[model samples]
Target: MWSFRTVLTTALVGLQVAALLAVLALTYFASQNVLLAYAEKLTERVARDTTTFTENFLNPADDAAALSQRLAESAVLGTADRAALERYFYEVLRSRADFAGIFYGAADGSFTFVSRDTSVPGAAYRIKTIETAPVRVVELRYVDPEFRPVSRRNDDADPYDPRTRPWYVKAKASPEVVWTEPYIFFSSQRPGITVAKAVRADERLGMRGAVGIDIEINALSAFLSGLEVGERGSAAIVAQSGDVIAHPRPSLVSAGGDQPTQRFAKLTEVDDPALAEAVASLPGGLASLQPGETRLTRFTAGGESWRGAVRRLAASRTPWVVVTTLPESDILGPIHRVRNIALAVLVAVAAATAGIGVLLARAVTKPIKALATQAGRISEGDFDDVPLPPMRIRELDDTRQAMRRATSWLRERRRENLALTGQLREAGRVLERRVEERTRELAAANRELEIANRNSNMLAHELDHRVKNLFAITSSLVALAARTATTPADVATAARGRINALARAHASTKDATDGTLAAIVRSVLEPYAGLEGFRLSMEGEPVTIRGANVTPVGLILYELATNAAKYGALRASGGTLEVAWRRIGDGCAVELIWSELPNEPVGEGMIAEPASAGFGSMVIEAMATRLDATLQRQLTPHGLRVVLTMRGLEEGGPLHGSAQAGGPAAGHSRGDAARRRAWTA
Candidate 1:
């Protein structure tokens, strides 16, 4: 059997070694995965950047052709004015240096072209005019930067005709803008492509001519040469036919010759063996790539593993793929270095952990053995006090001290046994008094709880009563609306509007004993208060309304507001409504005036009065009866005015003739007739 110290030390060292090994393994694999993902992202980013650059280089030419087509079709820049056309073409060419030429070829073989003369030392513009009206002759005029002609010549030998060019023919055949394949320009003998569009002379006429803009491919090559790929990595732009359009090495984009007839170099024809090999190793080569799709692959190039990504440019008119390749060594180099460092750290920690474990175990066991010897002495009935064994560990030292203290305590307890017996009797008497006092306190608490319970029950009964009242009012409104509405839809609309108004009224008085008259009126009109050209103003002395009267007053306001919105001031432009109130009759009643006026003059008989009372008038009469209020109306030349007198509106006052105060009475009998007359007026 192993000794306790040996077992403890061995367990500690073993656990430490296992944990270190697990951590090392996890780090090694996780780092590899993370680094691999990073490499993939880097490859995709390079390809996307190349695609963006190519699009930027080519988009302008397409835009220019479209703009020029519109201009020509609109007759802004026409062939009738040769000087203006030349100046416009010269400006376009100067503004866009990448454009080799701007030319318009007509159906009758008439040509007007403007091109930059780069063959000379200084800046010069050449305008080639081929007039087919009189005779087929090419006029070449070289002008300075100011557009002043410095030299002019005629070449009858030049056989350039607008009707036979590829740009003209393709544009004429297709109604939309057309792009030609990469080819050598006929005039400049430079490798470029033409973007062209057919122009119609008139809306009813047939095609008259085509406009073409030549974009130099050398600009694209130069842009590609500036991109920074990873170390030992390169990027290239290749067409769908495996022809190299652009490369980091400009010389590789074209065949090694000064001949103007030479075309762009093919992928295999380029000197880059690694790029060619990577492209060949792909699943179906460049032709298999689709627009807006990025594909990543791994292949061996030049005896080295490489990661490559090909992304097709989605926005380009031509089908082109950006190929980016990076060496695998560049990606794995950092991860390998990190793994080596981690291994060294693991070894060092393991050695240190072994040494520390042994020292800890020895330190622990020495104190335990000393504590054990002390315990044995106590078990053998040695109750006398003795000095404790010295220990470095706090727990072991505390045990030795406790043993010494226990031995002394046992000796003293034996000597004081009778004294303890006497004290126990006195403690029992004191505990009994405490129990009696606690009982009395608990009884008082129970009494208070009963009072709180009663209050809660009262509150619940009040809430139940209010909810039932609300449902009763809602049922009455629905029944009344159904009786008067012309259609089922009208019944729903009227009932919903009235109930929403009641809800707003209740919300205004929620958590409050009462609310002011102005607040109640504003709440009912809130929906129409913010409408443009319809002004609403409220002015009052702030007379308070009892809680029971809030809903009644709100309903009356809703009726008046609805009438105004439908046929009164609110229906017209620049309408205004004014609500003013004042305290009346011993400060227990309020008199409110509602006035409406339109901005324009009202002619006599222009405002048509209803033949009979409508639903709104009935609602007003009902709500007035509920409030026990009096209403009177007047129709003046300016507008309609109504006055309302509400009684028993003071707080803590009895509402006269109200059902809540007493039984209902006939206080609103005269007011009902007056309200009807006012509603019809």
Candidate 2:
């Protein structure tokens, strides 16, 4: 007799395993069918395309052969005292639109040619002056009358003696015309195939030799390039000897970089262990030959398995083959994808099953456990507290009723237990009374500590406020002193400027804000705004700083601006003020520059340090220190420039009211007012 939980779990596990096996079986069969279909389709496509392409491109050889025969009979060759033959050949090559070039091989091992230079049109016929034994191309040129280049033959060229050429040899072997393997032309060293025919001169006509047309292999490359296979698929032309002839990847023919070779090599490296071995053993052009049948082969290369097929070319005389490959993973990819999806769903189902199992187990076990607990409690004289579930099985209901009766009988005994418990609780309360009083004392101490902390915070904030206010007042007092001094004419103006400096500093110290240091400087210079000879431009990031810091930086910029307004380039016509700032690492700095215009003759500066520091100078120094900044000032011919660096604020805190406002400093007294007015002026 299995328990309900065990029976349910076993059934669930069995069902899940069965479902997994079923899915796997379906996937396996489906995958096999899909791969078989894919291979068949691929092979059919290869066979059909190869046959169609060959039929379209390859013309009947009889026409070409007869054309060759006619050339041998033409006066051009019959008279062929080299010069006349050269001229005749040149005319023929030029007249024939499809003729890339014409090559005539002699029994003496010398080849002659007259052809249009496709790379250079309208060029004179390139004649080969062959004097070498056999293989060396002597003189190849494209030149006209005076032997001057229509196209001068390249001096260093390989000779292509017609007798040695395979196409010529193959043509002479048979009266029918035929195509030859890709070979370098002796005259140009260019890769191409030659269509040649043996000279079967009639006795009635003076026919000299065989004539061949060397068609550039690139023409076939163009032909093959037009075939568009499916994604990640490609086709190439390979010689019967397995040499890559023409491919979409032209670089494969070159020596250095081997992208095509690497691609093919990768195709050979598929991982379905069986597929990998099959491809390795398979040869090219096997599948496409049969048209309807597919030769499915898989092989391993680079440690992975690949699926591929090969078929023979129908019209190709060179025994060419077309080989195509795809990763086995690609052919059966749908099945794998399906399997993965099924597995994912199975995982979810498994998880859900386990969750349900836990819930079911708990549901069934809880009632039995509750009954046992109640029975134990009843044994311990807790009859009045017997617990009953909301619903129960019929057997459990009977059990509960029996327990209830037992409890009733034990009720008198429970009264005895309750009286004893009451006495024990009274003893406990007496013991806890002293401990509670001690705890209360500790709680009171905590309250006092909390109050002290709050007070300290308030005091600190108040101190910061006052100190900031005091510094501002002092700055205002300095401004007032300067304004009251009307002694030296130059001194008085300077004094007035000092007062303006104070006002500038005060203006920047608004309520509080964030990332507004640049704004503060601009606000300070606002009084000098719209001044004709001076132009003020501000750039760089805006940063927020403590109120204490903003004041000094603002003042420094004001002093610099005032000087520029009075004596620097800003004084000259077309003068401009450019102020820019940026953050450098942990700190930020601003450069205030005044460039003098070419409009006016500027006066020379004192060029010496001041004998005594003015209020403005002192304030700038103090502010720089408080803000932890570096101050630099230079009076160039253009204008006066001042740069100030200041510490920036951290991420979050109380909103800096004045910083963002770019407003005037608030909470100022009357003395501060007079100073601000004079300085702002």
Candidate 3:
């Protein structure tokens, strides 16, 4: 019943329009749901982030108060030390910018406070002290960053007393730390809250005191104002008691006048219509919200739809609420715009398609059969370029020419593909060779790294062993010194001298493969060589001592030198000391002789027993026993002379019997016996 051209035009146009309409419908609905979800998620993320930030800002005040309480309880800080307390509070305020002030109030109505001084031009901190005992007066000192006083004022008429403040009262009553409700600071007149804790009377000065730190809320408001909410969106912090703690507009949260009783502004007085409506729309208001619970609501205010999320701060001792609101248009406006654009495109495209379809149907209906036959021939690879029957229409002729050109282009592309395939194969071979070389290089590098790691591990083990030995020696010295010394000062002096001797010995031998007896003697006695009228002479053949013998030999030398410096040779002046060593017993043993000549004459009876058989004699005897060496002392008219004979002095020789046989317990027993003998003598 229909002509071929008419049927084709009608079918093509109808199918295109139907497909376009279906795609538009699906895209619009899917996008609408996605945009709505995105808006909800964005609002919730803002609310959660704001709540977290608020908690962080207030946590520092709590921490500072706790720290102050501990210091007070431990008696490290007390009210009587007003100067120290003031300095400490000033430092705390300088370090913590968020704190408005730090103060301590005593039960006797005495107070010490430090706060930021913005009233003065060049002042960085202000110290306020109220004395109730000797004088009832307030002293104000404004200081700079270096604590230099810039200005000082005496306020004798000021009636401010910290004991009457709410923070002080609450802290004194509560056993634990407490936070006061948000109110205006007495000095700054800024809306803030205080974190305070009570100091037990028995702990410090036998009197009770409370410490408080004030945190301002204006910074919180500024933080909210700077937050990136959606366009035309706003956020606020509200307390459960119906006070607005923070708002994007900072002025809305603070009362303008000097009414301290009504310092904080209520939510209704903020003059933000959208925020007010959103809070009112919540069921039972923000007070009904539980901690860590989030509630979302929608409302209309000022003839615009608004969406909001209300979340309470979690784990907060203070009940604070975070509210974030956004207009509904911020979410749906973009979706609607995109939908309108799609519709316009659909209309333009549909009109063009229908018109083109009609023309195409009319033009191609006659010449289509001829074109199909030629296409079939081309599909079969018959590219002989045989001339076809001539077409009357120009479009059909041009299509015929284009088909020939396309066949030519296909043949050329086939030739180029073959060439390209060969080149790719060559490139693959080259890449394989390069990969093999790189693998070989990496393998070589891995082997080197493994060798280096083994060397590092070996060095670490050696260092650890040496450090442990040094610690053992130091601990023994400290214990022995503590046991024999009479006073704490004596203990410290004895231990420090012995430790220094050991440190010097270690440093001298740290870089050498083996330590020489002469080097150890010089290192131990170097400190006394610069004394006036003192002379030190050394005569020795360089004898190598085993690593295990270095510390003991060095300590023995130190004790003898210290005795000479204290009582015999180098005590007053004009003293000479001689240290000599020689290899003995087939070059395996060494004998060291220490000879001292003092400026003062010594009697034989006075030298029969050592002047003081104290820690020095004990140390010398114990060390000789530990080394398995013999120590002989002879007192002559010249001075004191000592001979120390040690075996197994060679680096390769077996260590001494005592060093190999004695553990810590054996060594300690010998030391105890030696100390007892010295005490008895």
Candidate 4:
């Protein structure tokens, strides 16, 4: 026989066990999510740090030519001019935010440089800046920078010639400056960045020599190292070209030095394909498809399932990308623990709840037990039943009174409960009917939505096709008009101008099928790229405008170009032209300037403002009005300037480093002859 105490104890134990299991399960899931979040955060942080590192690392001057200019300015010094070279090197190093060393590789074998080791006095004139590392100087007659063999000996060795190195060789081969990913310094045993420029005598004479700078990676490492993803989070720095600068694990064990190699033979010894691939494709921002607790894959090291985030560092110049990793287990582990604690608490509460339920059940049964005793007493012929000692519970007292009342009207309540139950069953039946009707209505709505979606897709496709055809038609019309002109020169000029305009509009509209208004203006006016004739400036950053608006802008620019080509300063020799547009407060402004040669007389016959409003003038006025712009035309002895200020297309406000009227575009690619012809004729 089970006593009450034994039963209660057994139930409590069972409840506790159930609660503990629930807590453990919840803990496991919560911990996993937390770890995943942490991993993603870590990756993002690494990416951001790397991007910032690269941006500040490059330290580009407001002038792009500054780097090359500095090299040229210093190269003029004599070979034996160590003091001048050192001064220039120190100045160059100081100009950068992350330079660890600066060196100039002249055509001659002699090399001059400054190192990060400030402890070594500037006056300490050793044959070479590096004193300790074994110098394996390889004279690759074939290699520009002969591969310097890694040596351990400190004895007197040949000067480590950098010309034989890849960085020096590549820079020498190209006219443009080159930046290399971070790598361990062969001499200093520290990670650093290298930027090289092919020194030239002037703009015309190219690649006279090469000057280089190396920026240390210690500060970047510090930034990435401090980021915490979760419990066990890690971060790494990678170059834009996917070269791993910093990582948590050592996939490639450099034999003597820390140079990472992709030799499959070495990778086979380790037998980690994932790690090998990761090493081979490192510094890349990508992930694998294999599913696991870890959300991101492949890039992270082996055995550690983790969530990953990545960001590109210092956007201005360097292409370093930072990757941060969070071990899923570490970040989520605490949350799981907290969940378990909560589950345990909930379980204890559940057990208490169950115990209370049992007590309430017992209280309800007490009255029945009392009734049984009373019935027995009545059977024994004791008519006077002492009213059960005043009931403790109100429900029990009500029950007792009900029982006495039932002695008089017991049959009526039984019928009432039965009748109410019958009514409840009928109400349920009606509710079921209503639900069915609602379900039918929902199905109809779904069908309607499907039809609407189909129609919308069809409409979109038709719109795209029509827009393309409209552009083609417009282009054809312009070509025909150019060809139909009566005079041969006029025909050729018109055909050329109209064709160019159409082509420009088409180029801008490549993304839109037909060019947007903004695209049309940019492409048509682009040929007058760097005109000294007039000041051309843009106020608004380029924007995508509607096709309807694009046509008007295109027509207006065509008229302006035609007038300038025929009679404006653009027709005069040595004249300059500038066309620019930009968004201002709640509007946009487009200005075109044609500055004539000094003392050049204005052509009254061809250049006097059109006596009667022609299509060109009308078109200009209409377009300006459409854009809600204020139009101005000013004629100066030096040039004619046209200004149009249109509302609703303004670029925010003013910006730094903005192009001024007559300034060249951000990336103008034409040569001198093209620029000169466009401005003068």
Candidate 5:
């Protein structure tokens, strides 16, 4: 089956990936900016702390000069005990580790200074005293930590003059403590700067001497190296003129030389490219940089950008710049690490999302496929007998419900269709039967219509002939009776009686409420019951005659009895006749027999046929034909025997003869008093 799983899964995965990428991208850049700003702030703080450390080191020197000035004004320095003064100097030497010397330079070009000496294999203090008497002269010496003279040297008369030194010069020029220009210390031959103050015992005794202390380059370099900057960070102290007086990288402070090598280099003239770039980016050559404010500088070095922070030390008399620089790459390393971690998390999340998409797509599509198959089954008229499992997906569940409803509806329709089919079959059967009955009725009606048409054509002539035959039959009977009458009145009475019998016979055939074979026979024999010479016997199983067939049966019986009454049975002193009718043949047909018994002597001249065989014979023949009956005659010693057989008599049957067979000669039906004289055989 075709499915949407692939498309849906792909869409879901695509949406998840796009969302993750968007989040990762946004985080990478956003965090990059935040982390870089935080690192910048950190680097600035480190630079500030380093500068503060340098400034604090110089503050002590200025405090010492203030103490000496107060003591000189009180005459304590000039009158102090020698041992006490030496103790004071020894205490000063041990006060700070970075102090190279504490000395006094006289206005007359004489100088004296104390120092800690370690070159003599034992801890000691050294002192330098200068004399300008008889040409400039100098002496170098060493001292114990207690200010006891440990070693001394009369070096030489030298061109060096303490009075001409910047410290003495600056001390005499200013009332406040002064900082000298950075230079190599005369005793240690190390680069240094001095903080000096002028001192006098009394105002009248003019300037006596300059008290000074020196900060050597080695001490400053140690302080700079101890700076806890970034992994690739470097620190330096630059003088106001952009001179690097001290730095962690000594090359950054000095040019290479052996002859009293220059201990400092201009900030812009530093040998290291990265350091030079850092120096070049200083704010106003570091002199104009404000204290407590970080001056951030970015410059390219070694094909990479570096950030340098410079702050002018507010406490330095020489006005120095404390500078720290770090590579931009290291500063952003943590940001990149965070970014990579975020990317990995995004990848993992996307993978999980894809997996979930596939699972959900299967969950949805499996049910959909089942529903589709069920729908196809329903289309093919198989509405039930298929299993439908439940689903978890919302849309799939809704669809399953709809499918169930559809299948139920189809089942209902199928049941209704089955019922309707049964009803239609029943209706068809009823319609078919009705159609057959109508066909039979139409056939019967067609037969009746044909009979009516024939009756229409023969009605007028048949009526005229029937009327004439009635008159003729009456006249014949009257003529035959007159020959046997004694008088004219007697002849008339006999004719009337005979005519009344014919009239009653016709009426009997007409008013037949009882139309059975035996009933009709009894009705016809009513007139002959009281005859003195006649005996009649009617015997047979009773049978009913159809209405159309009744008239013919009654008329034929009357004719036969008429002949017996005229010349055969009723003429004798003891006459006998028998009439019988019964169901015969297939139980669906019947027969009636008629014959006479001998009352007088048998003779060869007995009536061979009816005396005229005229009206009676023709009527009898017509009735027999209409009834579809058989007739037989034979001569016997007692009388003539006549038999008649009819078929299809048990039920109303098809007519075979005449359109008019209702009455005989218009008066001879319903018939004679004694209809049949039978042999009873």
Candidate 6:
């Protein structure tokens, strides 16, 4: 049979299990929200950091090209000093290892350069210089890493004109430094681009020259190759038009590699079946996208689902997207793992809780079952040989004791009824005696249960009384906090914060658990903290404070804090604040220092106190009196300095606080009943 104990326990435990499941579900969704936010922040940071690196790498080349342009406009190139020009190119090329060459072309079809020695493998000591004029000739030279020439010679080469070169034409058309299309250098046979700026010695003289630097594109490829995304995920930089500029995987951008026969490929033209399929899944062929736009798509690749994202590079001059792709397993594996772990925990807890409920129900029902047997014996009038067991339960034991007394009384009456029945001739007297004894036993059990019931009611009433008192006090504090306010917004701001502070004390211990003095200060300063870049520096050991002590402490700090925000460091952009505290005198007392320094200094006359006492001033002084600790205020040239020495609460827990915290429009409230009375007056 299902006993009352089993039903009640099952009902309670079932409700608890349902609640647990609800909480777990909420927790999972909340974690997903947090992790999604984290992932977005991570991607944004990666893009920004890469942008910084690219800018840093490229800015110097532009600066060097501009400097050479300025040098070319000077007399160094005006007189056509072949010797001076050759030396200048050599110095510039030697400074950067990746610089293929530095060149300067004149309007009169003359070109000169200092380029690497590509004629021999691993040759670093010598470089080639080619010059053209009335005669086209090439000079071979040796130089150190610092560009001091070691040897020089003139060489035979094909005729080349500076005016016919693409860079010279591009420079004349451009007012600022310009980058040319990527192409192979004649000397090195390696792909590169030139950064050039045009220079004129004198505009009226009609003498113009272009100074340029060629940077190898292979360096960019090497950099991009090192970047990675998630597991099995790779990043690639692709031009908006259609070209794949850089990628870690060679197959994605080229038919083969850095070879003469291999052609550079685009995302839309990869020969690899997997990559081709991935690109085909995109709605358009990568050209429809704009800068900073990101999109995700899935495609079947290598017999697995693949996820990829394409985001335009915000810093690239030409439209370029950074694409990251990986198999779905690589990204969703961890999420799946977390889900399985949560399910396991839920199952384990539910089983453990149900097991506990079953055991508890059995223990409770065992006693009640024994009591039921004793009640049956009394009802059947079987007083001679009745089975009655002792119970460990207090109430059940009391019932058993009552039944035993009833049995003893009926036995004595049965002996008297035997003697009287012989004279009166009625055997029903003994049965009547047994009925009377059973009724008395039932009445005694009822009285004992009533006493237990009264005790339970008294405890519940005490608990309710305490709860009501807390609410009444909170209501009073809220009302008092808004007493000085004239607007609804102001009243809301003031009343809400003080009430929240009281509520926080009830919700969490706040005695000592990592957040103590520092936390309390943050709660009071939160409103002012909303100002952009506004800072509140707090430093201290955890100060444990509790109970009524919070009232004076919260109120006192709020008063001083409101004043500081109104007229001190928080008012100016350049201003700063410092708050520090330390435990003192056997850790029973703590000394806290609050100091604010403004953007600029004020005169000594500004140190004077206020002309009239405001309500805030009255509250501050009133709470300060109750602190039973030393308080000092100093006015400096920069701002205000307030030092407080407060004794520890008589009984304190430890922690930070909980409050949604209104803005600075609302003020703090009177804490103690004594202080509230004075404020009202």
What is the TM-score of each predicted model, taking all chains together? 0.46, 0.42, 0.47, 0.36, 0.45, 0.42
Give candidate 5's TM-score.
0.45
Local error of candidate 1 at residue 463 (angstroms)? 99
Q: How much lDDT does candidate 3 score?
A: 0.76
Residue 174 local lDDT, model 5: 83
Tell me how far the alpha carbon of residue 265 in candidate 6 is from the true structure, in angstroms, after superposition: 3.7
* lDDT per residue as tens, model 4, 1-681: 443444555576577667777767776766666656555656655556555555654565213224543645564754346557666665655565456667766665446666544223232212233222253332211101122122222333565666686668977777666766556666556566677776666667645566777766656556655665555666665544445565444443222333443211233343334334443443432332111112234344566555555454434235544555555556556676777687778677767766765665564555566765655665564545357756687876786776556444644555688899999999999999999999999999999999999889766764564355345544543444454467778756765665575556444533333332334545655544433333433332434444445555555566665565556644543445555444445334433332323235765654454333654465567677886766777666666667666544423433233322222332433231121212212
Give residue 293's error in model 1 in angstroms.
1.8
User: Is candidate 4 or 5 superior in TM-score?
Assistant: 5
Question: Candidate 6, residues 506-591: lDDT per residue as tens digits?
Answer: 33322323334445666655444433344566655545565556666766665555445445665445556777776567757777
In model 3, which runs have C-alpha deviations exceeding 4 angstroms?
A: 1-26, 186-189, 202-207, 257-262, 345-681
**Please, what are the lDDT tens digits per residue for candidate 1 over residues 141-223?**
88888887778889988898888878898998887788888866656655688899998977578888999998888776777
What are the candidates' C-alpha RMSDs? Answer: 21.6, 19.8, 22.5, 24.7, 63.8, 29.1
| Candidate 2: 10-residue stretch with minimal lDDT | 672-681
- Quantify all predictions' global Cα lDDT against the true fold: 0.73, 0.55, 0.76, 0.52, 0.69, 0.62
Which portions of model 1 show Cα errors greater than 4 Å? Answer: 1-26, 120-123, 184-191, 340-681
Which numbered prediction scores highest in lDDT against the true structure? 3
Worst ten in a row by lDDT for model 6: 672-681
Report the error of model 6 at residue 494, Å: 99
* TM-score, cand. 1 vs. native: 0.46
Q: With candidate 1 superimposed using the best TM-score fit, by how many Å does residue 106's alpha carbon deviate from the native?
A: 0.7
> lDDT of model 1 at residue 667?
28
Candidate 5 stretches with Cα past 4 Å from truth are 1-18, 79-87, 118-123, 132-138, 201-205, 249-252, 268-274, 341-681
